[model samples]
Target: MSKKPTLRDVSRVTGLSMWTVSRALGDLSGVSSDTRETVRQAAAELGYVPNRVAQELRKNTRRSVAVITASTSNYYYINMMKGIQRTLRPTGRTAVVADIAAEGVYTRELEDATVQDLIQSRAAGVIATLTLSLDSVELLEKWDIPVVFVDSDPPAEAAMVPAITMDNFAASVEVGAHLAGHGYRDWLFLAYPSRWSTRADRERGIRHASERFQANLEVIESENDVESAYATLSAHLDHGSLPRAIVAANNPMVHGALRVLHERSFAVPDQVALIGYDDFDWAPLLNPALTVLDQDSEDIGVQAAQILTRIIEDQIQSERNGRPPRPAYQPADRRRVEPRLIVRRSCGC
Candidate 1:
């Protein structure tokens, strides 16, 4: 059997010194631009893979960042992670995905276990996608590791934490406006529990907008999973009257509601209008295309990782310069993204 290619082989193939090859592959500054590309091309051709574990050991500091999220299978996190990996490339840091079961429910045991894993893995910082418990925040604070939340706002009690979020409430208002303008005054909002900060804010926005137009809007809660949401929506349709429009607070719920609508053989827009948050490619291809609120989830991820990286660098620079300990907390930083409303056949437009 052939042995796995090593850095030595890349050096030999590229006709560069071992030190030059090492620096180039590691993205260190000492290598020239031409030499770096030459070494990378050689390594690619030779099937050479760097031993990240060995590099971490030699560096004595974790060169990896942990992304704490829920529902890794969801498309939202998938696109966000793409941005994270892209931004992290130049930093020479690796991304480790840590999935938390049931992101909406913040548990102490789960927090402890997750924190332990990050400590054991020696993660330099954390990029979180859900609400964190106070204890979880404090533990990272004590360790002096930074955390940046993505797609959700930091809990009000969480001090000095930064978050990359969307203007879900304003977007919700737009959704309500379009639905109401069409003389569809009766509205139903399907959502998961309010434990998720994102859901709560989006609900708030929709509610505010609906009230302005005197629309009769009712919010219903369902389980976070698609199947559970499907069941809940199915039962609701059986006993109660269907509204003129249904606003699903998230993508999974939207899928569930759509499935129920399909099963009931209801004509979208003509019978009952449907709209949802978080657009995906399949949205346009549905029997009657779906009107969706499209936001840049990837940009959210990139911004969160960038904030954490800046914090980590600042800390390292301070230590090397023998400066006094930097404050563990600063004013909580916040950024919001605006979403574009896509008009399609589903909204009766």
Candidate 2:
């Protein structure tokens, strides 16, 4: 049986010394551009996969990042992956995504395992969302990798990691303003738990809008499930009368609202108008197209990926100089992506 090819084989095939081949593959300086390309092509043709574990053992990392999300099955997350891919593809780097369980009891165990794997694999940076636990953050800090939180706001004292998420408060305010503009005086705010930063921010924004518009805002918190939302909205519908408008917090809630509205034989806009956050793909395809605040999922992914990349790059520079990386704000840092108010037939806007 033939043995697997190594750097020595690549060097022989490219006619470069093993040291030169090593530096080229590692992207270290001193190797000429032409020589580096030759070695790279030869390694690719030989189907050589660099031993990342060995590389991390030798130093902090090479040039790879990890993106951990609750699940890749959802729409918002799927779009976020697209954005991350768009940003990293040009740089010839890879974004490794670990999907923690979407549901059920094994979530904590799966999340822990995911973080441990990333650290053990010597990932240079990590982009995580709601599923990340405090213990995972502490574990990541002990490692050399820089962690980036997405859609999950950690405490301010979390210095080793910086969080990237939507300005939920402001985003909700836009929804409030839009409804208020359309004369939605009595309204209902469908909410979820404050466990996630996005939910908290969104609640804040809705509160702000409620105050500014002086609307009678009824708040209902649910577990973010179809049945929960159905029951919550159903109570409102059955008690007396539905509000003039309903602002669903996210896509799932929006879908739930639609079910209730349909069951009651009420017409959207003509009866009770509906608006939601997270403009999903099916928004326009609904019977009367959904009016929503479009959270640019791609933008979120792209910015998060770029920040993680920059942080990894800074760490590399810092290690060479025996100091922590200089604190600098990435242009993509703390980005509040604009949510466009798509006026559809549903809102009668």
What are the per-residue Cα lDDT tens digits for candidate 1 across 1-349? 8999987799789888665776678765456799899998998898998877745542444378999876564567788888899988888887989877553344557868998777545577899888878777766665456788887766688756888788888899999999988999999999977657788778998899888999998888986667767888888888999888999877778889999998888889898999988887688999789999988688877887777777777866755664422424445457777899999999997
Candidate 1 local lDDT, residue 302 = 85
* TM per candidate: 0.78, 0.72
Candidate 1: how many backbone clashes? 0
Report the error of model 1 at residue 98, Å: 1.6
- Pairs in steric clash, model 1: none
- Candidate 1 residues lying further than 4 Å off, grouped into runs, are 1-59, 102-108, 322-333
Q: Against the unseen true structure, what C-alpha lDDT does each candidate score?
A: 0.79, 0.74
Model 1 superposed RMSD (Cα) = 12.6
Model 1: lDDT equals 0.79
Superposition error at 273 for model 2 (Å): 1.1
On TM-score, the leading prediction is 1
- For residues 1-349, could you state the per-residue lDDT of candidate 2 as single tens digits? 7788887689789988765776678776557799889999999999777776555453544457787765344467778888888898876778877767453122677878888787567776777767366788766765556676777676566644576666677778988888889888888888755655577788888888989999988888765656667788888677767789888877667867889899889998888889887777888999799898886877888888888777767766765764533333344465455667788878877
